[model samples]
Target: MNKHLLADRVKALTPSSTLAITAKAKELKAQGVDVIGLGAGEPDFNTPDHIIEAAYESMKAGETKYTPAAGTADLKKAVSQKFEKDQHIAYSPDEIFVGSGAKHVLYCLFQAILNEADEVIIPTPYWVSYPEQVKLAGGTPVYVEGKESNHYKITADQLRAAATEKTKAIIINSPSNPTGMIYSKEELSSLAEVCVENNILMVSDEIYEKLTYGEEKHISIASISEEFKKQTIIVNGVSKSHSMTGWRIGYAAGEKAIIKAMTNLASHSTSNPTTTAQFGALAAYTGTQQPVEEMRAAFEGRLNQVFDSLNAIQGFRCLKPQGAFYLFPNVKEAAVSCGFTTVDEFAADLLEKANVAVIPGSGFGSDDNIRLSYATDLKSFKEAIKRIAAYVNEHSSASD
Candidate 1:
């Protein structure tokens, strides 16, 4: 029980705030409270039927053993073909490394590349895991504000300024997590130029690639050019796109050496991604593109349904997200107007009183905002927003 018994890395870890809020919501639900949770990042849909069948068929065929550390050859081939078809880019099997999930693949990547005191540039309003994972790899995370005015995106000048002699990598999460903003091709070209000029590695997280709405398309920085491709490692999977979160199959594609290092690390640590899950992902990439589109359309519909209601809440200011399912709204004014001192306290009261569970943005390094996911059904999402609006109206002290 002694604190000194734990490794320093374990001691330094920050738990995922998204998971913490989701767990609290589940706890309230178990108590028979009508809590509507907007904290979850994964799609609410079940894994597509064909992908489920593929896993079942693999199990029946006795394909339950461990795969190669990176992934199965056939699955890798399918992933390679997917890149070619979707991005107009080519990656050989050796250039790809698969792991239990995109999260795990990224962890392995930092472990493979980082040394003590190396820095990873992380833009604010980032995915919670990025900074934590960087620290776990003994790397320091340098933060740059992705001003909300710029649609929560960091500029190439910001990227160049954040880099130093010890800078090892920089992450670009287009169709970003908390804000759901997509970077344009010209924006990416400028950022890619910075990385190329500095010889800095670009860690592009494209897990939300298939979930973009309207005319906004997802662009991979690696697809920009051969030089950019050489400087980038893409982290992506079926978790969001195919509703395969529990299936735990994700992959990284990049230079052969880095992929090999990540593969070797996986061999020692994870052994391999689950065999059946790999087959399921193979089918996800090769099977009908219908289910992916269906889910995206549904999310877009929900976003359209509740966005106005959300923004209409007193003191709430939100930008319409171009992609992903989350709405990141700056709620500091709302919190203050509602007689609370901090967004965290305001969020706590919402859960306790309004029965709506939203993630406070303090966990994402942006304390003025909160994130609400539309991954749930339209009915629940609408009701949650309504509850939040009513709570704000009842508690407002602006007239005072």
Candidate 2:
């Protein structure tokens, strides 16, 4: 083997199918085909003007030097205050570490905490990066299924069955990515107790906490108790909540020792997050929250307008998601009934024939479904649903 070759780690990693599908849609559009892409998980709204102004001011003031690897004092204070006000938990600045994005924060976290051979329990269908990050940190990823009937949430009993002596951490994503299901306070309490009893660290990903519909509320698992708090690391940022995805600021708050270790690791990897972006995040936490509420309302309205029509598509059964902007509908029967061998093939065929792009559930640890993000305009989203229904109606008849 050549010593100049790619590292084994990079070779073993799987490229994100979500990004692949989105790019394919873009490719077709570049060639002049009409395509509706439902694979992106980003908001269509722009970042608020106040946040943008703050970042511009920071740059104009020549505050462009590298900040402390952990974070600037102002941004850290903002994160601390946000946590206390929203989650009923308080963290000193020393307990927090901000990174380029929530995704980067999570990577640094696994690197700081995991020993080789340690296991991280992840609930499925999870975000595409969870297991991959664990692998990159040399930790084993143990998956426990979150069944469809429970709206794709895991039970405390299932969590207990998956824990072991080598279990080092558990990741909880509330207002989850693909399924958009949120665990209630009662559900969170039981899961928190299991983690506490097992001395397992909990990594709560609350990136989508701001977008929920009706009675479903997002709860921070770390807020369950002081004991739970001591063992939990709450990870979040302004990407989803403030439409600041491009601004690239996310953070982790937890026990001082772990946060310090993550901060040290971050110093060697990506030096502190972008300075201007940190100021933007500071404004995101302190400025008027009306923009956040308005965006949430818009997502809720989109969900209401598209849910029934999406579920009514032939051979598809979709649960009304309680939060976030995604809908994961079981399409295994639909796929087979439509003469496609799998959801992946069906998704490809939809893109090729109806010019619709969707991320198949096989990428999210479930082959029976496909995930759709309603973060685009309601007019386009409704049209996508119509195209999906037309595709299913036209193809599923072959099964009869």
Candidate 3:
């Protein structure tokens, strides 16, 4: 006799391709293959010493048990102070809810708000989990394509077009995942005007808020206008900024009612982030930013190195990213010229032949691109690009 039961929701969801590729690279590495993985989403840097020390201190002080559903009062106050200092937005302690990670906070938000057939507008080349999370919350995901000419940023026109009565929310991730594209203040203003007119909820995922490079200033969409602030949920964490991914600490600031609902959801799900992690995050927010700045500088330097190397290859088109440590190159020209019919095939062949693991853009809702994370050291960046360039040049049918 066979006994099997799985929820339809669980069965219907597709596993994350980003995580899948990372796992595949791990499998090959265990077999002693020299696979260079460019698919990671977290920083390669270690958590700063001060943050670790804070966690240790917390544990020693008996802060190992559960706290409030929202978060520890100290961490919440620290998060509130951070928003005031950095974004110039003031959030009360009641307006913040912390969870296992920004990802978990996002999941709880969706779970709290979304109902059957509710629609969420997501820009293409988005983070891999956005659509899946929406689906799990019983919401329909409406993807609006952002073009390369626009730096893959969704326009006000697109926002206006995608809005409908069933629309519940729209996700905006600047210094976006897969593509390190950022929305300027003027651009966000335009989108905010549309959101304001339409009365739609904006979920701003700013996990990479502090990882921006160069002169590009990260703007919070809520900070654009009072109405926008009222409708927006700003999701942030110490994961990317402080290299604290494993700490599982992230928070959301928004309307008191929404925060309350999210906190209620968190209480049932995880019942607050780890006590030690909250203490660590508190330290991260209160500590000096020298470590964060050092990491950002290294990422910026590596970005330039990777861009120059990839551009030297035939048929590879790259856009210089303003923030984050990712390069989403348009490989369509190279893929076609190299006799590959699709981006997936191009990526698969490269992984099999060159042993370099990169995520295909199809996973991020684009068809003719592939994402490379430059979070590793310069040596790995150079070697990975060298292998990629050599493989592309050798495999090109145009060379014949």
Candidate 4:
């Protein structure tokens, strides 16, 4: 028998749907077709000036070589201080592990913690990588739906029901990707209680912590109590908060054993995050936070300005997002009205016909919904919404 060219694990991984859609949009743009893409997950803004300056200064000062497998002490210290200041939860440098990016840190974490057939419970409407990561680590992904009626949040009772002897961890993403929904303090308290009782690790992805708006606040599950803190591992970075996505600096904070294990795994893989980028991240935490808030205010303004317009399209229903830059609207009705049987088809048609690109929510584990990002400029975002509205009006049948 002929051997397979690739490992089974590699074959099983799903290509990132966000990136695929963005690539198609770029392909059309290359051909001179006007395409407004709402598929990008990162902020469209450039890195803050001080951050860039800090990286440049570090490079000039001969900080090019790596200092540790986990991270430089100064960078880890900055992260520790950041956790103290932002989450009100303290983490020593020993408990922190920095990797090239949050995605890389998460990959390292699953590698260190997961064993064959171990199960990780992930909420549906999750970030696309969670299940694939678990599978790559030789673990099974048990999904619990985060019902839209509950603002797309899974309840504590549902979590308890999902736990089993093999269940090792659960991820909680506040100001969630795709949906832009945040879990409230009371909701987190309930879920944390369940995790503690069941001895399940809580992986809190707080990369979007600084991007919340209005009355909604991002809360770290680790901040509820010392016991909860021990059970939770926080993954956050400057990528979203400071628009430093390309800088690739993200960290994890948790129990010493897990952090040490992740550090060891990272040593063999990425070694350390980019030395210059670490300095930029350090500056991001210690420097003035004015630019962070400035970006947050811009997102809020765009959300307010275009939300009503997007929500008013025929047969569309969008929950007002409290945080994050993406709007997830359930487009099942719209798809059916437009004579498309699936949201994916509708999304493709929008890209082809209306020249607007959106990420079909099927990739995020919700087939009925679609994600639209307001991370682009206000003018383009508004125009994209208008195009979508116009397309639906023209194609949708009133009798259907």
Candidate 5:
């Protein structure tokens, strides 16, 4: 194959730094290194047994054939009911479409909506995939910084400043990845108004809705009003809620026109999401809420413990995230105190010397922070934190 013949779009694409660093960590672990990896974003729990059993039952009943391009009607209806049951947002089956995972659902959405020269406003410290997906769909990503002082969430005015005639959409993630901060109902309403005023679509990624800690509750912006309902599209999945990441099931619910367009695109591209996975997802939406609660409690427990540990390190500043299972700490001062040139360099040194793996903040569009996942066991997480604290202390320039 001639390398030159590859499409320019494919050539220009940026690979996911999180996955790359994760792979590197795995390689080191395979060689028997005592590497403590805190890079994964998924829950470590297994799929709830009931959901697994339902998929088995479906397969035994010969439900393994290709489902509708959007999803099986039964699964679609379950997703719709789940929305109303959990978020109080109502939608019909025609407005719902399940795909391979939330990521795939988002990809198809961008492909369906974006055209050349269009722009999508994305908040900084974003999930790594948002910009790349927008670019892949031939749209530009306009970044609006969610200041650290503001708990890493941009205000309505900042969003307004970023919108342009070519702007087509905005991506909002609650219990956001990297930061784990959730937007309050008031904040969502203000931003929703901006989207309405601009006639821009709100792409809400709520995959981490079930993992929030403390008094934090996840709210859907679309639930604010009928007008917001029209302006918003929700992308979510059973992956996080059911600890079924490997099962590969996610869905989108929104305006019928967009759902139909995504369904047609999916029909041609994927034919259908994996047949068995859709059945598994159906069980997840309709299954018992007990397992989800158990996992959430476990995550909540880990978050508080890890949050305290993170802030204890000298020069390390971290917010107690309201949701999600990761910690994003501003380690710029810590990195500088240790005489490292950049956070990326400090991260590399930590992985090699301390045998601890964390993602550099640069990949998430912030160069002064590092992301640590508390998805692993409490024991291992403490050990990782201990090693990090020791390394930074031992190498402090002030000490020397």
Candidate 6:
């Protein structure tokens, strides 16, 4: 008999549906299908010229040697200053760890902290990777569902009910992935109180910190109190803010001990983020705010256009998002009325018939929704929505 080899954890893991959809969209586009993809998560903007120049200069200066496992001192200090300036949360250089991206830093933290059977409280409609990463780290993911009535924000009572003696941490993604719902200061304080009382570590993903719309300021849970800061890990980066996703530089600020452990894990796994990327990220932190604000304004304008267009369609319910570039509209009513059994079917049909690609809500732990990224050019955005609206209207009278 042939020998079979595979780790049980690896065998049990599910493929990322979001990435799968993105890949399929790309495949269709490559085949000259005129695919309008609303599934991409990253910004469509290019990295700023100044930041790109910094990376070019670094290469010329031969700053190619490997740096510290965590990051170079300059980058770490830049990250420290960023927290102080933006979030009003102070952090020492020792409390910072730089990784390839916020995603990598989060994975390393989980690998260091989670033990077998440890429970992690995650709010639903979360980023697709949260639960899978927890499972890969040998932790159990306990989901707390957020409803539309509350603007998709989970309540303190919900967090309390999901907690147990075995619970180790809670993942909080304000300006959340699928819904783009941000927790207000009051809401964050209430949830922080629960975590403080229960001794739960809070992993706050603030990657989209600068992309908020209107008066909805992004509040860091760590900024609420020193006690909360001690238990909270603030994960952020320049990917969304500076449109530097391809640069692959992200960092986390937290208690010195936890940061140290994450750095040690990095030492063994990936030694450090690319030297050039770190230099570019440092420039991103120190550069002027004009580019960042420009991108934010564009996203805000596009967001309004998409939100209004989606709300006009029959059987579609949408809430105006306060942050992030994506609009997640609930299409359950449309699914039921148009003979589609699930959001997945709705998305697939739209792609086939309307030639528009979107991510199904089930990928983001939502069953009745679909996420549409308006990160493309305005012309493409308008055309895609027009096609989508027409298709839904034409199919609206069908019975499931």
* TM-score of each model, in listed order: 0.99, 0.98, 0.98, 0.98, 0.98, 0.98
Model 1 / residue 350 / CA error / Å: 0.3
Candidate number achieving the greatest lDDT relative to the actual structure = 1
**Over the full model, what C-alpha lDDT does candidate 5 score relative to the true structure?**
0.92
lDDT ranking from best candidate downward:
1, 4, 2, 5, 3, 6
In candidate 5, which residue ranges exceed 4 Å CA deviation?
A: 1-3
Best candidate according to TM-score:
1
Tens-place lDDT digits, model 4, residues 1-400: 4577789999889999999999999999999999999999989889989989999999999999966999999989989988888778889899999999999989999998999999999998999999999999999999999999989999999999999999999999998997899999899999999998999999999999999988989999999899999999999888999999898989999999999999998888887888999999999999999999999999999999999999999988999998889999999999999999999999999999999999999999999999999999999999999999999989989744
Candidate 1 local Cα displacement, residue 264, angstroms: 0.6
Q: Comparing candidate 1 with candidate 4, which one achieves the higher TM-score? A: 1
Name the regions of candidate 3 deviating beyond 4 angstroms: 1-4
Tell me the tens digit of each residue's lDDT in model 1 across 201-235: 99999999998988879999999899999999999
lDDT of 3: 0.90
**Candidate 4 regions with alpha-carbon error over 4 angstroms:** 1-3
Q: Per-prediction count of colliding residue pairs?
A: 0, 0, 0, 0, 0, 0
C-alpha local distance difference test of each model: 0.95, 0.93, 0.90, 0.93, 0.92, 0.90
lDDT value, residue 5 of candidate 4:
75
* Model 2 bad stretches (over 4 Å): 1-4, 398-400
Against the correct fold, how does model 5 do in TM-score?
0.98
Better of 4 and 6 by lDDT: 4
lDDT of 2: 0.93
| Cα deviation of 7, candidate 4, in Å | 0.2
